[model samples]
Target: MDRQEKRAFVAFLAEVFASTSIVIVTENKGLTVADVTELRRRIRATGSTYKVAKNRLVSRALEGTQFDGIAPLLKGPTALSWGADPAAMAKVLVEFAKTNENLVVLGGALGSQTLDASGVKALAELPSLDELRAKLVGMLNTPATRIAGAVQAPAGQLARVFGAYSKSEAA
Candidate 1:
């Protein structure tokens, strides 16, 4: 590519490295367009972006960034999966990798924290952002639900009793 294109990509990658909560680097060698399109669609569905970029530009982008730890892994047919929600992206990549044999995950970076293969695996296994939010909402709603049930119990019993009395009077 031209120098201007490279510079623009570097700038873009630098911004991504800065803003993203997590970045997963992969070697997507020999992956077909169909596979890539599927992966792209999945990433876009989750408000994420997947890019196959040149190593030089990626290396330049990693300069002085928090995710500089991942710079070295940019070699080969490197594709980056990045988004605002790191957990979601990781989960999606891991799940996608289960079926797509061509995509090999090298490692990743979660902010300043560097993740090895095992770290990435662990992250993949953890509940996603949406799952965590759902769990939290369930936890918060539980007490309210219980309280409503408790409050309605006596009224329900009283209504049942009155209904039975009226039925007996008719008998």
Candidate 2:
């Protein structure tokens, strides 16, 4: 690549490292083009993306970024899976690594905090932001649903009682 292209790519990587909540570094060595394509598809489905950059370029991108701590993990056929959702990339990489032996999980960064392989696994275990929000909404709605159900029950029973009494009188 030319100098201008390199500068643009470095800037783009820096932007990615800055804006994203989480980025998982991994080695995609010997992974077939089809496998990488599949991984990208899966990542996009979750509103995330996978990128492979040269180690030197990624290291340069990390300078002055919160992801500088992750520079060590940027070696050897490194590809990054990143997204707005902090949990998504770690979750996807950890799961993919489980099935694909060639895709080695390197440490990553969630903002300034550097995560080891085990930490990445732990991150995968945490509920995603969306999942937590859904859970909170469900929790908040439960009481209202129960209140509606309870309020309707007495009226339903009263109607049933009146219907039974009327039928008996007619009989």
Candidate 3:
């Protein structure tokens, strides 16, 4: 890229680093275009983005940012994947690395915290934000449902009793 283009790209990276919650660094050594395309598709499906940038450019982007801790992890042929949901992003990288050996999980930063590869894997194992929200909604709804059932049971029994009494009186 030309000087102007490189500067613009660095500026863009800086903006991204400022806004993202998590940034995962990976060594995409020998991944084919198809593999990368598929990886990008999977990541994008979860509202995340994957980028391959020069180490120098990425380091420039990391300057004065909370993600600067990850600069050391940006060695050879590295790529970055980031998103608002840490677990979801980590999960995608870890799972993709498992399937494709060429894609190596180096490490990452979650906000101001730097994570090792194992830490990234652990993050991946946690339930995603959406999953956690769904679980919370289920937990909340269950009690209300049980309460409604409990409240209706007595009324239903009373109606049955009144019906039995009327039939006996008629008899």
Candidate 4:
């Protein structure tokens, strides 16, 4: 690669490391072009990215970043999957790997903490930010709904009682 190309790649890697919440490393040795394209599609659907860069460049880019510890995992035929939501990226990688044996998850770095393959899988099981937010909103709404029903109960009972009393008088 030309010097200009190298510089551009380093800059791109730096941007990715800066913007992402987690960086997942994988060894994509024998994955076909179609398989990679499919994986990229799935990752893009979740607003993340899948990239394969030189290990040296990755290590250089990782230096001084929160994902510095992941440099060790960059030694082999590494591909990186990363995004704002760690769970989403992990989920995609794990789900894709389930069907594609060529994609082997090595390890990853979340902030300063490095994680093994199992750790990445565990992360995949966690709810995403949007799911967690939806749960929170549901919890918040439940009490309000119950409160409204409780507040209306007395009036409803009063109306029912008046209706019954009127029917009895007519009888």
Comparing 1 and 4 by TM-score, which wins? 4
Q: What would the TM-scores of all predictions be? A: 0.91, 0.93, 0.96, 0.96
lDDT of each: 0.87, 0.86, 0.96, 0.91
Model 4 lDDT on a 0 to 1 scale: 0.91
Model 2 spans > 4 angstroms off = none
Judged by whole-model lDDT over C-alpha atoms, candidate 3 comes out at 0.96
lDDT of 3 by residue, 26-131 (tens): 9999999999999999999889999999999999999999999999998899999998888998899999999999999999999999999999999999999999
Please give the lDDT score at residue 38 for candidate 2: 79
Please report, as a residue range, the 10-residue window in candidate 4 with the lowest summed lDDT.
69-78
Q: Which stretches of candidate 4 lie over 4 Å from their true place?
A: none
What ordering of candidates by lDDT runs from best to worst?
3, 4, 1, 2
> Candidate 3 — which residues are off by over 4 angstroms?
none
Query: Cα RMSD (Å) between model 2 and the true structure?
Result: 1.4
lDDT of 1 at 42: 89
Candidate 3 vs. true structure, TM-score: 0.96
lDDT of 3 at 111: 91
Kindly report which residue pairs in candidate 2 clash with one another: none
